[model samples]
Target: MKLRDLGGVVLAVLLLAGCSTSPVTEGQAKAISSDRVYAPDLVGRADSESAKATFLRDEGYFGSGCSHVIYVNNRKAFAIRQGEGVSLRLQPGEYSFRLETGAGMCPNIATSQDITLKPGSAVTYRILLPSDGNLRLTRIQ
Candidate 1:
């Protein structure tokens, strides 16, 4: 793609990115990710609250340019670039987590994993970026 074309695609992606609420917070992302974070909308509870689950994206530079979006229960929860991570505070339940590429110019790639969250327990999921074509979401903590 040419320079202007790539710029248009990035602009379009930025505009479309704000349409949803991300479960991850900017503060948490900054603390974990070694790269950059695109999705930072807070959709989870506070640290003082009774948090049941936490989702973190792996810190890597393989897919740094594309927005690595994390989907929880089939919804867009957050987008973490290479080296970026998110800590989410969620309620107790069974949640399906997945990874996807950002809209426009990004590859249509994805991977998913399921976990059951219990009360007074903290569950964690991790998204590993290996390439622009696909990503893996696995339980790490």
Candidate 2:
């Protein structure tokens, strides 16, 4: 490749990268905004003393038909489908969270994460199945 052509190629690559975003900002930005929370059947009602927790399922084709389960402090909290979300008003404390699909790669894996939520504060978690098919529970915002 010529030097001038390579410079042009590098510029193009940089511009493309700039146009994209991190994984946390990805997947239906319009729907995942803080105000647009999903509250099916008024699940997890929040009071002035409760912290808001939201979980969003990735908008991917992998495991689209499977139900994604959310465990808060080792208890079954919510089950969400693809491109869907759930909001829970939880009591603030140190919490352990885990995600399970019961299908796809590493189905029985017990990978989990922990977070400390404060009363009257809000947080969100995202469930994603990447190209490799491993399930992940990521805290986004």
Candidate 3:
């Protein structure tokens, strides 16, 4: 109602806005440091019935109930060594990713995503090469 009162209110608002945000440092953001990565030991195999390519839950977080199915096709294919497996470390957020065996079940792909990973935790997903081959799923603590 008064000029002096209005000026005080504006000053308070400005101060609050100024204190709202501060630039984040690397340490504070927790950017993926090399030390935080723990590659999971995944073993690939073929499906028994189909005799096609399939990945099984072998080591690490295998049997931890984090099992999932993923499809990898020529379009969205991610190359993985025949014997050597791959690992990914994700922070707290929602990630959409695709995995492929690099080689067919009609579409020759099983896709899963919209995965909500918790902070400081991980999940394991596998793709079986053969219908009955050994596929390994592992999670890291």
Candidate 4:
């Protein structure tokens, strides 16, 4: 291959190598927690007073009443709630949170939103209900 072509190939490989899902370095993880507040909005039946909040840990779902979510840093998932706000400490990176709502009479109502968190940053999102009873995600910060 031509020298220029070979160099281009090497550069491409390096760029792709930088894209990985491994947890951030220890220093980076610590920095992330201090830098940002990862708060997502929780909108629900408008009558749900359980303060139910759900988040994804290394194991699995940590709480109940979590229907919708926002992925943060590819490492954590924040669940949507109603009224009351939810909070969590997570490593820095990119995430996608899937928003959901109640079932049965409220089954058909659901919505989701995406958010990206940087190291040492706080993200505040919103959960709201449409007039028709469907749910929608709103980012506050």
Candidate 5:
């Protein structure tokens, strides 16, 4: 192959390597789940005044190989893998939910929404990562 052709091939390889979308391994996922530290005030106490919130990821073909970090009320809640979901019991109040791309992955792909939770109520939110690489939060319930 010509020198110029070889250069082109090398450039393509570099670009593809930089565009990695590898999914989180099982061990990494477990570590992420175990490393989460919730606020002490938010830990126990399930009662009539507590509200339930569920977050689900889209798991669509486009970005299903990547994991995202979820932040609740500006606190690091947990990491949500593709097609996975998590539920939390929170005190009835207003909360802000945000999603971000995992480390070494896409940049500038964060989205958030504010929701008010009432006692004895349950709410569900879905995270969508479209082709544009921007995160979208939608309320499905």
Candidate 6:
């Protein structure tokens, strides 16, 4: 094979590797629940003593159909499917949210913000899978 052709093959392999999707294991799938109900009308109130935070993974029809395991403050919170979401009532404080597929290739993705929750505030975070195949957290509210 020509040297140029060999380089092209190498580039293709690398690109495919980066675009690979993490497979959801049976245990991980079992750990995820699809029963969470999202109430749009219910949110944090100004007079309330706690805040409401919701994590949504809205991949629509473009997702790989794999369940993504979510971790809040290092504890297994719940799993969400495409177009599904989960919510938590939290005290006013700083928190860390992480998402992982429990796959071997794809590493855990986390929120980049300070994630400070204030009393009577409601925040919604959407998990986005961009064209580059990396997971990102974006605040929609």
User: Which candidate wins on TM-score?
Assistant: 5
lDDT string for model 6 (1-141, tens) is 999999999998886655443433222322124343222222323347788877766533334554576666776666667555556777788888776663444455544445888887888777766546667676778
TM-scores for all candidates: the values are 0.58, 0.65, 0.33, 0.42, 0.66, 0.59
RMSD of each: 11.0, 7.4, 19.7, 17.0, 6.6, 8.5
Clashes of each: 4, 0, 33, 30, 0, 0
lDDT of 4 by residue, 1-141 (tens): 999999999998775554222222212222112212344222222222222222321111122233443443343344433333345544444456665545423554444555555555665544554433445555545
The local distance difference test score of each candidate is: 0.59, 0.66, 0.35, 0.41, 0.68, 0.60
TM-score, model 2 to reference: 0.65
Return the clash pairs for model 1, or none: 33-83, 33-84, 34-83, 60-83
Q: Model 2: which ten-residue window has the lowest total lDDT?
A: 29-38
Q: Write the per-residue lDDT of candidate 2 for residues 13-126, one digit (tens) a residue.
A: 876554332343334532333333233333546788888877777665556656666777777666666667666777788888888777543365455888898989888877
Task: Give the number of the best model, judged by lDDT.
Answer: 5
Model 6's alpha-carbon lDDT is 0.60
Off by over 4 Å in 1: 1-42, 46-50, 102-106, 131-134
Which whole-number lDDT from 0 to 100 does residue 71 have in model 2?
Answer: 74
Question: Which residue ranges in model 6 land beyond 4 Å of their true spot?
Answer: 1-47, 104-113
lDDT for 69 in candidate 5 is 78
Which ranges of candidate 5 are over 4 A from the true structure?
1-45
Model 1, residue 84: what's the lDDT? Answer: 47
The digit string of per-residue lDDT tens for model 1 on 38-64 reads 334444455544454555554433455
Candidate 4 stretches with Cα past 4 Å from truth are 1-81
Candidate 4 residue 30 C-alpha distance from true site, Å: 27
Which stretches of model 3 miss by more than 4 angstroms?
A: 1-78, 101-110, 132-141
